[model samples]
Target: MSQHAVLDNNTHRDLRVRIEPNADLGDAIMSCVTVPAEFRQVQAHFPILFHKNQANGAFNAIALFGFENGENLFLEGGKWDALYRPLALSIQPFLIGRSADGDGPGQVHIDMDHARTGDANGVRLFDEGGQATPYLEDIASRLGLLDAGYRASEAFFAALRQHELLEPLTLEIELDDGAKRSLVGFHIIDEERLRALDAATLGELHEAGYLMPIFMALASLSHITELVARKNRREAHG
Candidate 1:
């Protein structure tokens, strides 16, 4: 349970949070989330996919880390397996929340009850003069980047939808129990359609700086092989 409060030095002095590097801190059921401007780095490890919120009909780009629900294969030995951890997962116990004043925009808030937060064993939040510590400053910077990245992605998402490059992906996998599972309804970049685009359209994407990230998203699809292999290995071990 999260009891988020606007982070303050006076109220949180002497507080220390033991950042868990190895543990899987992301949502257990839906391990995937939007990567925004971090797609270039995210694509190197996770498969980038286009997802639509059925309830709100919002389209966003996401980095897929596992095949089935609640199964993040990258999690092992009480830690994450990959070298590049997504920003969404790294900035734990902290998030962009609604401003208390309700005046301008969202502000940063921390889950006061998070397992990482305590009186000891983690980075300090503030100094004696009630100023942010170095650790806190770095966290603030990361959060800023994450917020800006998501905002910037809106335009890129629009370009993708306009060009009709997003297409649904379906997968057939046999689990360790000899049960065949069909992963469906998720979307991916349609490479064929992307390739078939005209020079003018290509120029537009290039001018808009959407070309590279699109290629990165396409490249990340290869990571699906790693997911399949992990599943096969799990079944064989069993």
Candidate 2:
């Protein structure tokens, strides 16, 4: 269970958040959420794809960590090897809360049960004078970015659906030990359909700032091979 409360100086004066380096620190089950706003950066390191939420039938973009569940191949020696880290993972133990009006600016809330949160030792949430610390400010900023990025992604994903550009992907990967892995049930942009889009449609997507992310997502597919290699390395070293 999570104990979330709107962060304030009065209640959480002595609160401290530990920044741990363990791969399992974050809820990274081989895939982590990635917003369209960071697709350009996420693409360079991880393969970007869309996952379907079974309950709501909604799609969410994700940066894959490994071919199998609970396997984060990017983790080595308690460090992430990738050049880019997903914002979703970085904003740990903190989540954006809904406004009182159900819109406008969000409230910053913390998961008190998270292993990183405690009053003992770490970055303090507030100074003795009741002002936000640099650490808290940074968390708020990143949390805001994540909220905005998620909103922006809704329209971008809708555009992809409207143009019939999203396609199911199934990867057949071979391991270093001659074992084969089948990865399925994820979605990626269809390059052929994207190329076949009319010039007018392309212009509209470009004007809406969705073109760059689309291309970036398409480019990120190449990183699947890198994921395979990383898995193989883990298999060999473990």
Candidate 3:
């Protein structure tokens, strides 16, 4: 359950949010939606994949954190091992909420029931002068980026589909002990198709600002080997 309320300095003056990396704060997911704007940074730390939304039939880019449900390999000892975390995960406990009429500008909404809220030693949301603290300001900025990125993602996915660049991905992993695990229901960029594109098509994609992210997503696949290594170490320790 969640209790959401529009953030106000007067009402939430003493509210402090714990910003540490922890699984209890709802970071235990195997993956989360990502955006093209984050692919450059996210690709360095996690594999970028595409997931088809069953309800909407839309494709969303995701940052893969684990191979199975309820697993996040990057999270260990209450700390995220990656050098960069995706904006979707970092902007937790706070979301941009539209007004009642739905035509007004977005407002910052905090989840009051979140584990990060009301921590005694957490970062303050407001200062003594009833002003938003630096922490809240940063969250607001990230929220803006996430909002804009989501909007831009539609064009990105359309470009991929128009060019038929997405392909199903099947991962068959063999652990050190000869145990096999298979992960399905994910899609990735088709490098062959990308390379086969004509100069005119490539130019169009470059002009539209989707080329870099495509390459970044391709580069991110290398990190899958690292994820397997992490899984091996964890199981060996156990």
Candidate 4:
């Protein structure tokens, strides 16, 4: 796809704002003069606040977007954070932006708490609290597992194994106490793949104890590909 088309495609799939790169930071600040109706709707639901300051004939604006009650994850929070964390840690001078003027530049900043306090330099895109949504927490709790750090797939697999789900070809996942229920598919790990994993890796999984099964299941299902890819990319560059 052409560059514009590719960007357009991504914009559709994700929540983003474009600002002119060349424009004075002040001009960029003013450019958000009108909040798009869709954004206003989002503002109504979540805390999307902007502060603009005038100095040296230039404007400095900081926009704070908050996710409340788990709704904003799709727009610009936890989901994006989960997807980008591994990649961000590897890349330096990493920033996301856009330009107000088409020919100018724009930027999107991913801010994370871990990035702050010198834990990491990049902007944090996800809230740690939101990372453990009740639905996911329930999944873990029922299976007697803990979060494998902030990685969702790892946490999921940990829950699975803790609950001894490996032998079951298929199982009923009760999402809630009500009538809601869904069937979860399962796959058996082949000996080749199992054997390929070294002792240290196996030990790490075992160390996770109840969490090990969940990570194994996630690995088998390929749910951790993005996280693993990001981790590999970071290692390559580091």
Instruction: Pick the TM-score winner.
Output: 3
TM-scores of the models, in the order given: 0.87, 0.94, 0.96, 0.18
When sorted by TM-score, best at the front, the candidate numbers are: 3, 2, 1, 4
Clashing residue pairs in all predictions, respectively, total 2, 0, 0, 32
* Candidate 2 deviant stretches above 4 angstroms: 99-101
lDDT of 1 by residue, 150-169 (tens): 87788988888899989989
TM-score of 4: 0.18
Q: What is the C-alpha lDDT of each candidate?
A: 0.78, 0.87, 0.93, 0.28
Model 4 misplacement above 4 A: 1-169, 175-180, 185-238
- lDDT per residue, candidate 3, 123-150, as tens digits? 9999999988888899999999998899
In terms of lDDT, the poorest run of 10 residues in model 3 is 98-107
**Best model per lDDT:** 3
Question: What's the lDDT for residue 5 in model 1?
Answer: 87
Q: Worst lDDT window (10 residues) for model 1? A: 22-31
lDDT of 2 by residue, 37-72 (tens): 999899999999988777986789999998778888
In model 1, the Cα lDDT at residue 126 comes to 85
TM-score of 3: 0.96
Task: State in Å the error of residue 208, model 4.
Answer: 21
What is candidate 4's lDDT per residue for 1-238, written digit by digit as tens? 1123211223322222222121211121211211211222223222222222224321111111111121212122112332211122222212333455534433333222211211333223233532433432332332221111222333434433444333323323222223332222223333354556668766765675533333332242332233233433433554
C-alpha-based local distance difference test score of model 3: 0.93
Q: lDDT-based ranking, best first? A: 3, 2, 1, 4
